[model samples]
Target chain A: MSDDARDEETVTVAHGGGTGRTRDFLEDSVVPRFGGDADGLAVGLDALDDGAVHEVGDRSVVVTTDSHVVSPLSFPGGDIGRLAVSGTVNDLAVMGATEPLSLTCSLVVEEGVSVGLLEDVLDSMQAACEAAGCAVTTGDTKVMGSGDVDGVVINTTGVGVLPQGAHVPDAGLSPGDKLVVSGPVGDHGITLLAEREGFDIEGDLTSDVAPVNDLVAAALDAGTVTAMTDPTRGGLSTALNEMARKADVGALVDETAVPVRDSVAATGELLGIDPFDVANEGTVVFGVDAATADAVVDALRATPLGAEAAVVGEAVTEHTGRVVLDTGFGRRYLSEPEGEQLPRIC
Target chain B: MSDDARDEETVTVAHGGGTGRTRDFLEDSVVPRFGGDADGLAVGLDALDDGAVHEVGDRSVVVTTDSHVVSPLSFPGGDIGRLAVSGTVNDLAVMGATEPLSLTCSLVVEEGVSVGLLEDVLDSMQAACEAAGCAVTTGDTKVMGSGDVDGVVINTTGVGVLPQGAHVPDAGLSPGDKLVVSGPVGDHGITLLAEREGFDIEGDLTSDVAPVNDLVAAALDAGTVTAMTDPTRGGLSTALNEMARKADVGALVDETAVPVRDSVAATGELLGIDPFDVANEGTVVFGVDAATADAVVDALRATPLGAEAAVVGEAVTEHTGRVVLDTGFGRRYLSEPEGEQLPRIC
Candidate 1:
């Protein structure tokens, strides 16, 4: 490309929109230099899984990192601190590491932010760590000049251990596998969008931001979890699509079976956003054995966080690498989200 | 504090200056909630050391995190990518983990950043990883709306391994320990300050930014490393004071012995900055047993990166928790840096 064209090649929100665009950027620029995987790593960048599982003395150590720049810092139900901790912990949980060994937090705060607000955020983070049975063992802090950053951006890295043969990848799904979702979807994204845009919806539209490792542990104890991933940036549609493409299998979802809170659905309708395409922090989609599907659902439903658990889909051989959504009246393909639906919704 | 007074409490650049103000913030706001150490951690947040050492079975796993937000992106000798990787890697190295097992990177880019520039940065990061003999196993990328963030901010977390009793802490110095500096001081801070301020110096002023794990490993092999810390943010003065205060000993320094490049010395004089009070990214200050101090210096000098290695000081019991400088004519106390010598020097 010429200089003019290259200069015009600026990044858009879509590049980080957790869709095909994001995947394209990674595969083109990052994967080539960094490579997909390295020696002694069970799940490296190539898999694009929730975490990287490093092999050490016949044991698997999972490591993952995420940077959170959610707007407003404080939301209706949760704030950036809570979101930062839960996002990392949930990533580890989905990678079959239910209990994180430790976590490292790095905070980049813009000048002029109130210390009181920072304290509140730190308190929320500590509370979340306690809830997840983990702690922030080490952290780094940096301050930038005014206007260099908005509020604060937090980056967290988590480390955990998984049994040798128990390593789970998002691409481990089979054609006969059943899929289940732990509780309602879209609550986190819809609530944040409403709160940011000042929708003033009637019902309570609190964010479902939480760490779901406890619920995942319960599910694992009940049945076999073949593949798992948390619906985050691109929501359920993008997550299911990724699993299908990576596993080379098709996903058939019963639209009516996917749980959605009444308030979230109404708010999403008001905003013209599909709940399935919105983000969720405290939800997980698990691919399980057909024989243990109901058992997993029962196990999830037994917990408070998973009270709304349901069997939403199944892996199939037909329509490989596609997600088929059955809307009761008809069936259509669920395409991955294209661009930024709501940026900084994490 | 009242609401108005609390609201007036805003974070300034000094809070992140790596000086007394930074120490106060960590102790008052962060350390209280996060605590100083935990059960399995050998050195936790409270010590304010280089990294956290988590005891896993009979071995120690060192983990550290750092976020880089240097302006101009590309500088004389290095860029943010190399700085981010080297910063995290050195943290682990100073904690007695010379070989990093893996690293995780998180990038937060503002809209309008050029893709080519990003590719260049990633290439630099890969090169730094290769130099340090490590690889990035996993990473995340997020883009914020324009005006929400500056050009780009990179956060990296490194994990490494050490033996059961080989963990090093910045506070492990004793009364009779000797201090060794690997190379010249203030190269990184002075070079960036001059570059950012558009100063045309006569001599070459390249940043001494590098991964000095090999140099540190060599020093360790030649002597008993009682304590170690990198003079990153507040230069040699702050690091020595921290060691003295934490270990309850006094540091006596020979002012003429510390190494300072001629270009750096001239630039520091022009900028009204003291070389001892500025940052150095590619250097290390070691507290070693007095018996093997010469051997440690010899080992460090044998390495290409540590030709200027010198024994600059020693720990003494006379004036506990202080640093005294002997100028060959008179002796005076060297106070810790107050605040914000040069913002974003890293």
Candidate 2:
């Protein structure tokens, strides 16, 4: 059976992306049924927060979990090991965490996976942990029968130290708030897609997978940033949609203002995929006060990961729960997040 | 090719089991190379601790991550969801945490997974989290292409709050300490094997999947328990061997004293498996002062999950780094954990 036909019969590729069927599944099935709780869970499925915050005495620790099942475990610029660390590190960082402290690494390997390959992955993990300043604290390893799993899948859970008396309100977006993105969009997604599809028109289109905790810290220090999200699986569209819905505000973004690397845009055009619908490994979208938007953008540009940061749009008062995009021409239309075109980007 | 013959060609079923190839891989490949670190990791690959413990301010918080890939999704008595939560919960509990505060559930689903099956798994996860007094805090879901992954794999990471001034040294076993099992063993492993091999056992044999935090709390409250471990992948034999090796002491377990259900023993014999080498989901092995071992066992027996708790062995000053078992026939020999008979039994 063809891929599309088979996907319609069960779970579709969109079910794993940031928007589309993934959000629908969580909202319609998983969230409504199991979101509420009596326990002292500071954050859970209910809020759709990047991480879970648990009260710990006078302070709180933000925790997030992501399964890294990227294909070609090793890729340009980064590997799944690095992606795993960077993914969780960015999650906590976007949640206003200053220090990405400790992490737990869980691994499930298919039988016959070479010992050398596993060690290489471990070396990558060690290096990534060192670079991100996150320690691998606890973990478990399980091997599956050769045919049961493909290669290896690593899931990393990170705990970050949120500064005392500080929280970047995910639901605090308001009219006139500015929207900003860290660096170029679609780099990681396009890179993975190129590798998968064997696109040969590539000149070092490496993934933008790196820890953004330092950038987030700098932005927080510069100004009052309200909703913060790393445009990952669903890219910018999903990130803006979440902020718009939770903050009960509309988002007005300029299509021309969004930063997309030239190579990535060309690749996206060739693959028939929209940049906004793709995934990213190291990127942050933030809503900040209009007054400090420029300063925050400047602060972001000073960082390595956010060097190409730009002020893309502003939260608006109309069209609550929706995002509207303005073309470079005199055209305005509702923004629709495309279905999944990239799977396992992180 | 035959199963055994094929296994020899690649990663055999033994690599996934608690003992045998799994330990060897970690020691030879994982430990010597990637184990040493400059980061102040409290628990890592070196110690082989079930969970990693990190100091969070005045007190400590224990963190653990496990990827549950149990086949059949729905087992006779428990499903993968319960196993996922129970496995990590037990890991934290055996480390001496009375409560597992928060859990993050990450899922990797195949494109062909039915929506109904996914919901059922989520429901089980919700129920298991509620039962374990842990909340599903934050999670990520990814879908792989058809045939990329088998069914679904759930990775759960738990964070537990450690009580003030309470530290359970997992390797600090004294010669005078007695060894105990929280309840009967081999039920989970034997049940899974029976189901996989289509063994039509006469009596009902259900998996003992559960959270043992309450039992650990009771035992810790009752007396001086030096170390605690719940026999999961490696069962009683592996657990004792770990304690013996880490504590640099010998373990003397009485074959008649070790508690094993008659049905489990019979099933193990019939299947050519050793009861001691099999896995147990809800059981814990404790090392306590000889004077307090009975009281600790009594405390354990008071709990519903530990109703069959028994004092089965004691730490010895002789034969460090080894375990000796005394057969009822008046013959004693070294106990060896068998090759993997059942994979994915978590």
| lDDT (Cα atoms) of all candidates against the true structure | 0.90, 0.81
Model 1 DockQ vs. reference? 0.77
Candidate 1 residue lDDT tens string, A1-346: 6767766688888887777788988898887887655668888888889988888765678899999999879898899999999999999999989988889888899989988888889999999999999989888889999999999999999998777757789998999899999999999999999998999468599888999999999989999999999999999999999999999999999999999989989999999999899889999999999999999999999988999999999999999999999999999999988888788887
> Against the true two-chain complex, what DockQ does each candidate achieve?
0.77, 0.50
Q: What TM-score does structure 2 among the candidates reach?
A: 0.94
- Docking band of candidate 2: medium
Question: Please, what are the lDDT tens digits per residue for candidate 2 over residues A18-85?
Answer: 67677788787678656775445566678888887766777777888999989989888889889988
For every model shown, what is its TM-score relative to the native structure?
Answer: 0.98, 0.94
**Local error of candidate 2 at A197, Å?**
1.7
Give Cα distance to truth, residue B214, candidate 1, Å.
1.1
Which consecutive 10 residues in model 1 chain A have the weakest lDDT in total? A1-10
Question: lDDT tens digits, residues B1-346, model 2?
Answer: 3545433555556777878677886776556644654343455557777876666676667778889989878877789988988888888888777687778889999987877777778888878777777777778898888877889999998887775446575686889799999888888988888888888387588889988888898999999999888888877888888899999999888889888888888888999887788888888889999999889989988999888888888899997988888877774655557677678887
